[model samples]
Target: MPTKPTREQWLRHVLSSATLTDAIKVTATELFLEMRANLHVSVPRALLARRLGRSERQVSRRIQVLKESGFLDVIETGWKGRTAVYVGMFKSRGSDAQRVTVSSTLCEAPKRHPLEKPVPVVAGHRVTPWASRHITIGHLRHGVCRNVSTDADASMLEHVPSLDGHAWRSRTAARLTFSARSAWPLLRDTHARLAAHLHLRLRPVAAHHSTAARKRTTP
Candidate 1:
């Protein structure tokens, strides 16, 4: 008889696929790992949701996604007074055929458009900073400052708190992508919130030279 794939082996294939996010991949792998050798998983959605810090509805959606992806099969649905039963169908590893299949599937995964493009902008809309083609790290950093300037200079007070800059930018971009219809409004709210408590100037005094710069006037 063929040996069943280990939980780690299954996880490698799941992660390599772009059909699910990291969180869903981890949750689905854990569910299978906790199952018995028979591949029967009798876990409650509420319990899984609590463990994953997600809503029960969200957990259910994730399970449905897994089912559609052919990784899981719902043996029995959990309804009143019963827990759901699922069977993991992930195949055994340690074979050339398995490796080739996984590689081919991964290569066929849909390619996501680069985030630098104006994908969040709806059609027939005038371009603004929020709808601009490229939102760079410097754009978000400038949003934290109240003053406007021609060059990339710190002409105003540093209003944002000291935090990981890259993470903040990523979060902003994600939020923007999900609300394409209200991208401008969402960006305005985010900028306002991130720029709150505008009393700090933590940089060195030399860094504040731009603050002293005056607008050039015609002679």
Candidate 2:
């Protein structure tokens, strides 16, 4: 049997396959959950798009991401005139027959996720705290989440099958943070100017991550 994925794995897969930037994944998931609730049969892509005001290509792409991430399963295939209809799998199946037959017992309301917290915004819209290795900024529709990484922060990508409008992105964004140790060089070299540039206070961060002294020797 294949090893079951942990919460972390699922989280990463959802983010990656959704082709969603950190800020948009939660919105995407919520949209998906809302759409999944009233399904009798998985309908045509064009219809789904019209309901959400999203382009048909966008819905199709997200579906492909969901499928590759194991969040959605394809059971049978059909046609609405010329549009293809796919049976969606939200859970495990025993046979090909099970895939086509969706069960109400299997479909459940999406859980209320608590991770969608608000972050400070610039002009009342852009997310804030700037950027740092220890913390990441992501948004969903209007919500955002921020977390700290004590050590070096790492980001990796997962391969998801491509869909007509679905996308998973692996591009890394470079950001500098004014609060972290790695930022000492910029902080020290031009403390006054950098502070003004970033609108940061000139005061020091007490304790300053503990590793501040040790890394002085590091490049």
**Every candidate's CA RMSD:** 26.7, 30.7
Which regions of candidate 1 are displaced past 4 Å?
91-219
**Whole-model Cα lDDT per candidate?**
0.59, 0.41
Model 1 alpha-carbon miss at residue 24, Å = 1.3
Tens digits of per-residue lDDT, candidate 2, 1-219, equal: 996444344444555542333323543444445433333235667766776677866666655654543455555654556644333333333222322111221244567878667886666332233333222222211122233342221222222233211121111111222347766664344434433433332124324534687679678
Each candidate's TM vs. the true structure? 0.38, 0.24
- Tell me the tens digit of each residue's lDDT in model 1 across 1-219: 998766555557767665566767867776866777676778887888888888887777777766656677888877878998887766323322322232344336787877786657565523234343333335455555333432333343344443443455456546545656646665666555544422132233324544555323323
Clashes of 1: 0
User: Candidate 2 at residue 63, lDDT?
Assistant: 59
> What is the TM-score of candidate 2?
0.24
Clashing pairs in 2: 19-167, 19-168, 23-139, 23-140, 57-165, 61-165, 61-166, 134-149
- Clashes per model (N, Cα, C within 3 A): 0, 8
